[model samples]
Target: MILFGRLRMLLLRTIAYLVDSFILFILVIAGFQCFLLILGLHPFIGRHLYSITGNELHLWLFFSVTIPVYMYYVTMFNTRAQATLGMRAVRLQIQTPGRMGLGKAMLRASVMLIPWEATHVAMCYPKPIWIDNQLQSPLFYTALGLTALYWLLPLLNLNEKSAHDWITGTNVIQWQVPTSKKP
Candidate 1:
């Protein structure tokens, strides 16, 4: 396999993430519709999503709509391809020291939720582990500051492994052609 350095890997990761985000957007929409239909709340999907302000159940509702997204990523990572659709598009694959064990893959999936979901605070309002609580300014800024640092930590590392990567013991690398032929 071809290992990519920090800059190249980050560029590729961003592209792959954008592509995956689009896929996720579609999944989220479809899943939301399905969820609405199942709950007889189809008519409320549009407004409810945007106006989730004071609803206590909105937290669980959001997770219900989001679980399939995590499933897609987890399943793709564990598959023989070992890459999501976006990763495949960019000619990248995830690698571990050896063939990734099932447990590692599962843990990687769970750990991935950290940075992926939480890092957006730098660019937007804070989202967090305990979002049920109202976001006071101090807490919001604190989370945003921490998230900014979390996102930047990979840049400080030569290996390009982000916080989740370090926790999960995985790397994103370029795909290698089985045989090189140049005459």
Candidate 2:
């Protein structure tokens, strides 16, 4: 029974994180593209900017967006004791074993923001020459597969050892607000 409860919590947390990430990703991409347009770097389709510039500008954009997003995710998870927008909606929070702290949150964010994930995204360029042949399609696929597996790790908490929980030494538990007594 305890194990099942933990598993349910983990699944909920994962779902919340995914939902938040998807929304944030879309928003960030759109915002960045808009910024580019304002600066006269517009590409016809949002996803084709890299192809148009031999991936030079694409790399710049990825780094620019990733750093701040990572900082925000880690800081919030560590200090405010919540996942980003998505996690909060589902009432899930990332916390350390005793109390959440900045160190743990930063660690979690660092691992989550592995460079390979960003590099794989850069691999989607239609022109093969844009990226090194050594890191072409196969590397991209592997990184993407790993990312999917990471997200799915929450489902493996049948015994209460979820991936995110393990990574951050934390657990996602159901939240219940305490009632206040009226004076």
Winner by lDDT: 1
Error of 1 at 64 (Å): 2.5
The clash numbers for all candidates, in the given order, read 0, 0
Give the alpha carbon lDDT tens digit for every residue of 1-183 in model 1.
233456667788779878998888777766666767789866455554434342433344446544667787788888887888999999988877767767777777777665444433322333332444335555456656665665666678777777667887888789865787799
TM-score of 1: 0.70
TM values, all candidates: 0.70, 0.68
RMSD of 1: 5.7
Model 1 weakest lDDT span, ten residues long: 120-129
